[model samples]
Target: MLSSLVVSCSITTSELLASKAYGAAQTYPVAPDRAWKIVRAIVDTTAAVAVEERREDGVLIATTESHDWHVATRFAIWIEPVEAGTRLIVVSRTVRPGAFPRALSEKEFHRDFAQRVVGNDLDSHGPKGK
Candidate 1:
């Protein structure tokens, strides 16, 4: 397990919905609706098609198509509206343990997800930034 290693980044602004939601979405490059399109593409084009199983109360649950080495896996994305901004919490759990390994998936996630999801916003405006 990752101990004391809280990997997170955020952007803040005066615009409640704008800065909060927009900043949380780094790779959007446009508005929220456009961002959704980008997100949908990522999920659809995954190794195997991953469909959203549950999405309620700012939380999303998705499962990938099972394969030989890649068994079924669940990924959760939690969007929490905080006082200053919205917090995006992400987690992935291995349901089947799979024939290969799940950590590879985790690494893949770290590789492109962060920047694609919210790296742009972070780059544009973060901490003392605009």
Candidate 2:
């Protein structure tokens, strides 16, 4: 009976943490359409596979390949239009309970995303190749 109670508590704690959002939000100085395109590209290149993508709703859910410690990592990203620009919110969690957290952190994701967006801007304005 004691073991069962302990197991129940562990499951409850894991569920609570998994349901909570574990990412950060950043607003970019760009339109939603442009941000959406860049976000999709980023997810496609990074995630093992995109489980679902809803452009109209501005939501993308993806999963990474399993590693030795975890079954897989899941990412849920949302892009919305804000007064200043587009706001992106990224949430990552482990797919299996008790598995290690192997998903990319919010800061790392934002850094990569910012670099891509800036690179795109630069490429667009640079001199055209002959």
Candidate 3:
């Protein structure tokens, strides 16, 4: 009984955290600067607005409030250079309560945003040619 209770509590805590934030990282065949611009474009269009943008730190943060979902979500993105190309990391966090499911929200959030920016010509015109 004690062990079962502990397991249940752990699952509950994990689920709660998962709902609050989702993170995904991907490497693209592009320069970090180009990747940053593409990411800025995607989030500018999809996110309600960029609450904070820091180019020096290679991070951009945006927030959106949806009346339909009755929730506000923030997306934080990081861009860096890898040996082969550029790596982008995105994390979505919910700032307010809503009807969104807690268990799989982060994965869904990542899928929705990452898919929009990957495998495209937008990054082809990097300052440094590929």
Candidate 4:
């Protein structure tokens, strides 16, 4: 029984490690520069550290703090210009196998990003004073 349990645990760990990274993409009605700025700000606020940034190529890599159950979660974000506007693509995965999944998922990250972008737009164009 112990041997079987050990095998099961090993399989689960292997599967987690081998899992493909997942991502989410969204297009915003804004310029790539604006989108890039927003994304960089968001990463700076959320990530433990910024790993690499390629503004010319519109790529930003960052990692979140790691806890007892999991290693740091790595994020790779890409900003691209589209016909309609700017597109943001975010891919995330665990740095290593862990007992738990990433604290934040790609979809959640996009939601937060969209909210921030819209909020920033409102703040910039809203009423002049209170």
Candidate 5:
């Protein structure tokens, strides 16, 4: 006898960057505090130095510079309370010459944030049949 397994997948463009700024919004099925923690972790982990942080208002702004690569970027995160759960808006900008830096930042940030909230790896690579 032989057995087989099947899986399904979907892809969508939920956010895009414009005007040299990359912005994306996601709603997680978690409380505002929980979402805030995730955002804080991302900022603390990736930021070179925090330029401004407002916990009470649910906002964090950080600036980072890659000395070896000579790339400078700024990050802004906002957490908002919502009926479904928590809403997150992240915006990023690159001071150094680069293309789609903010968009790239948002993509990575969203991937990590979503995976943590859902407790699963969201690797978007095409499914591998086994």
Candidate 6:
């Protein structure tokens, strides 16, 4: 028998930076991390990755994105806020890179990512909108 896994693991911080460092971390058993890695690798190679890195307090923050007309661009962002709240903010967007020839498909992918991966109604709340 063979297994075909498109996504795996959790986008959990504790699991990722677990080996990196830090404590008081949390983990979520989902497909965000794997998805993020996959998105980055695919876009970075096929297209061009424009990334930005920054460090705050003790956490390493980064946002990587790529653009291509033939395929959708991956937008995976993770922000851990430490102050009055200890939470992670993520925004994953699969856009058509930009508006050009096939802009309709880009719009479709964006809609899909929002409704499926993240959720439908994205409020100023958590994943559960609480």
lDDT of 2 at 50: 36
RMSD of each: 13.6, 9.0, 11.2, 9.7, 15.6, 14.0
Cα TM-score per model: 0.45, 0.67, 0.58, 0.67, 0.64, 0.24
Model 6 lDDT per residue over 65-94, tens place: 333544332232343444433232333323
lDDT by residue for model 5 over 71-128, one digit each (tens)?
A: 5566667777899998878776664444634422777777777766765222232112
**Clash numbers, per candidate:** 3, 0, 0, 0, 0, 0
Models ranked on TM-score = 4, 2, 5, 3, 1, 6
- Candidate 1 — which pairs collide? 26-118, 26-120, 26-121
Error of 3 at 96 (Å): 2.4
Q: lDDT of each structure?
A: 0.40, 0.62, 0.53, 0.63, 0.57, 0.32
All candidates in order of lDDT, best leading: 4, 2, 5, 3, 1, 6
Candidate 1 residue-wise lDDT, 1-119, digit = tens? 11111111011111112322322232212444333443344444454233442334454444554566554555554454555444444455455433544422534543444455554
Off by over 4 Å in 2: 1-22, 68-71, 98-103, 121-130
The candidate 1 region of ten consecutive residues with least summed lDDT is 1-10
Name the regions of candidate 6 deviating beyond 4 angstroms.
1-48, 56-70, 81-86, 97-130
* lDDT comparing candidate 4 with the true structure: 0.63
What tens-digit string does per-residue lDDT give for candidate 4 at 1-130? 3233324332332333233234477888888878777776666655444356778866776666667645566667878899989888887666555656774567866876777666763343222331
Using TM-score as the measure, name the better of candidate 1 and candidate 6.
Answer: 1
Give the higher-lDDT candidate: 2 or 3: 2
